[model samples]
Target: MRLRSLTLACSLTALTLGPVAHAAPHSGHRDATTAASAADKKPRPDDTIIAVVNSIPLTTRDVENRGKLFALSTGLPVSGELMDRLRPQIIRQLIDERLRTQEILSRHINTPPEQIAAAIAGIERRNGMPQNALRDRLAQDGVSLTTLIDQIRVQIGWVQVLRQELGARGRVSAKEIAQREDALKRQDGRTEYNLSEIFVKVEDPRHSEDELSFTNTIIQELRKGAPFPIVAAQFSQSQTALDGGSMGWVQEDELDPAVISMVKQMPVGAGAISNPIKVPGGFVIITVNGKRVIGHQPGHVITIRQAFLPFDAPLNPEHVTPQQQQTLQKAVKIAQTVNSCEAVAAINQQNGEKRPSDPGELQLERMNPQMRSLLEGLPLNKVSRPLVSTDGIDLIMVCSKKEKNFADRSPSEIADQLMNERVEQTARQLDSDLHRKAMIDMRIKLKGV
Candidate 1:
C-alpha cells in the first residue's frame, strides 16, 4: 500500500495517513517513554471479541492497542479517564477502517509491498528516528507494529479506490481551468481564508443532538491539547479528514455563508475554532488558520547566505566552554570582514560547518522581529553581526531581495485547486454510498456506559 507518513504536528495542508510513530510528550503530559513503560505493565487478553464487521472479529486487544496508538499520536495520556473518553471514537474509526479495507480487497486491489515499506521509512525520517526504530518504539508502547501497518494499508487502498471511482471525472479540462482563472482574476482583491475543518455529518435528523454532543466531546479533547490532525483522522466524517481537514486557501465566497461569517471574525497568526456552523447536511467546526487580502499584500522575499559556527556541546549562557567562546570569537571576526555573500560561503566551507550556504528565499514578514529588523534595511553584499543561539552562532549576508505578489497564482495552481474540489465531492458521495451499502454490525456501544 502506498501510504503517506504521518508527522507529530502534521502540515495543516497535506493529506497524511498513519499514526505519529515517534512523538514526544507535550507539556503537561506524561513523558512518552514513561507512558509506554506504564502501558507495558498492563496487558489485555487477546481473544476477547469487542465488535464484528461483516463477520470479521475485532478483539479487545485490538481496541486497546489502537487506543495506545491514538494516545501516542495525540500526546494524550492513556489513563482510565482518557481511555474511557476515546473508546467510542476509536471503535468507530476501526469500524470504518474495516469497511474500507474489505471493499478494496473485494475488488482485488493490490498495493505494492515496497510502497508500504517506503511509507514506514518516511515515518522514521520525519520523526528523526533511525531505520527500523518505529517497530521498536511501538513495542515499547505495548502496541504491535501490525496495528499501525494495518491502518496504513487501509488508507493506501482506500485512496486507490477513490481514484478508480473518479476515473475520467477527476481531470479538469483547459476550458474549465480557464474559467476558474478568469473568475479568480475578476475577484482579485477579495479576502481568502486559510482554513481547516472537522465535518460531522448528521445522518439522521432525529439524532442531531447526539451528533452535537459527540462533536462537543471532540472539541473538549482538542481544547485539552490533543493534536487536531490526529483527531480529524480518527473522527471527522469529511472527505478531507485524511488531509488533516485542510481546505487550503479558499475565498470567502466559495464557502457557505455561515462558515464565511466565522472566518471573517477569526484573527490571524493562531487558529480559532468556531461554534458548530450548521450547513445543508452536516455541522462543521471550522478553524481559521490565517487570512490575507488578495492582490494587495506585497511580501518581501529575500535570499541570504549564512555561515554557522558550532560548538561541541550546547552553549550555556552562564558557563560557556572555551571551545564555544573560541567559535563565537571566530564568528564575530568573520562577520566584520566578510564583504560579499561569496566570502560567507567560502568561510563556511573552509570551517567545515556543513550547513547550507544558501538556505533559499524566505519571506521577510514571516521571520522573527529580531532577524527581520536586522536584515530589513541591510544592503546587499554586507554581513550582519553574529546571531548567537544555544546550538551555534550565525553570520548572515543578504544576497538579494524582491517583492512577490502572493495573490497572483499561476494556471497550474488553479488547476490543482479545481481538481481538489472535484475529488472532495466525489469522495463524499462514494463514502456515503459505502456506508449505505455496507453490512456494518455495531455490537459495541459507542455511547455512555
Candidate 2:
C-alpha cells in the first residue's frame, strides 16, 4: 500500500485532533496578514514550551492542537483524563518525528516541493473537495497547514533516507526471485493474509510495561477512528512504516507465531487485532486487509450490466406512489422478459434509464454476501429478478465470468516480498543506531502526563 496523503491525514488528525470549531473560509485562500495578527494576539500562558527535540522547541499549543485533532478525527471526547493518557505518546511521536526529520536534513535529503503539493492535491481529491481545500479545513480546525505539510515532508524524506540506505541491495536478483517463486509454489493451498502492522519496539525488557500501555492507547485511537496507515507511518519501528506498514501477502510460516495466530483470527476489512501481540523485542498491532486460500482459490472476475429504474421519489411501502408502482412494474417486466445482456441493454435504452448499462467488472469475492449468492449459480447472459435497493430497482445481467488460479505467483511479486524483508531488517537496525547516537532531551514530565 502506497501511503496516500489522505490516509495520513485521517490517521494523524482523527484520533489526535478533534472536530474543527471555526467555519471553513469560503475563499479557500490563506490570509497571511490575518494569520500574523492572530499569532500576535496569542500570548497565553498555556503556549509555553513543553519540550525540545535537539534544539527544536515543541509548545503547549502544539500539543493542544494535536489533542483536538485526535479527538475530532476519532470522535472521542477530549477530556482531561484522555489528554493525560495521550500527552506522553504524542510528545514521544513528535520528538521521533523531529529526530527523523533532522537526520534527513543532516544527510541533505531534500523532498521536492512539487511532491508535497501533489500529496496535498491527492488529499483534497480524496476528500471530495476543490484544490487547496485542506488549508480551509485546517484553518477551521485551528491548525496550520504547515503542521500537516511538515509531517508529510518528514515522512517523504524518511523514505528517501531508507532508500539510500537500501542502495543497490534493495533490488532482488533474478535467481533470488525464482527461489522465492518456487518457495511460494511449495506453499500453495496455504492461507495468506494481506496485513498492515504497527510495531512498537521495547528497547529494554523493563520498559515493556510502558510500551504495552502506549500500544493499547494506539489501539484505542484506531478503534475509535484513527487511520491505521497514518498511525503506522508515524510510529511503527519497522521499515514497512515507509509504506504505511503494509506487509503485503504473507503465509503463516513467514510471520511471527503470535502474528500468525492474530492473522488467522482477524476478520478482513477494518477489524484489527484487539490487543497487542508480543514478539521478540516489541509488541505488534495488525490489521488484516484480506486473506485468501492460496493456489486453491480462483480469481473470479465478473463483468455485469445493470439497468436501474429510479422512482420519482423515495418509495414508501405503506403508501406507494403511482410513479413508484409503475416503475416497479416496468422493472419486473424487464426482469421477466430480458434473457441476454443485449436484451437488458435494449430494455434500459427503451426506458431511457439514465444509468450506465455496464457498470464494469467486479471481483466475486469482494461483493456482498447477498449479491454473491444471487450470482453464484447464475447463468451467463441471463437477467435475474429485479433487486430493489434504497436507490433503485436493478436488473443485472452477468456478461462474463472468468476464473484463474490465484496461486500462480509472479516474479515481480516475489521480488517485492524479498525486497520488503530486506528493507525491514535494515530499517530496524538504522533506527536503533539513530536512537543510540542521538541527543534527545525530554523536558516534559511524562510521569505526571
Report the number of the highest-TM-score candidate: 1
Candidate lDDT values, in order: 0.70, 0.68
- Each prediction's TM-score versus the true structure: 0.75, 0.70
lDDT of 2 by residue, 1-449 (tens): 12122246435433323343321110101111232234424544666776776788887677666655555554555555455555555666676777888889999999899988888766554333456756787677666677777877887887778778878885778989878877877887778888899887766766567677778767876776566676676667676666777888888888899888777777787566557899998888999988888776577988888776766665668878888888888888877777788888776666555466776778888788989989877888787887875445878889899986665667767777777787678767876777677676555444311
Off by over 4 Å in 2: 1-47, 75-77, 221-227, 265-272, 302-362, 368-401, 447-449
What's model 2's lDDT at 115?
88
Candidate 1's residue-wise lDDT over 1-449, tens digit each? Answer: 12222332243112122344333222111111233234434764766666777888877788788877777666555675556545555666677788788889988998788877878766664433457877787787687888877877887788788778778865668898889878877887788877888887766665566557657766666665556676677667776777787777899779999888877787765655677788877778888766777766678999999887767777899999999999988987887777988899988777554466887989898788978999998889888888887767878899999999867777777776777777778777876777677676554444311
lDDT of 1: 0.70
Model 1 scores a TM of 0.75
Error of 1 at 388 (Å): 7.9
Model 2 earns a TM-score of: 0.70
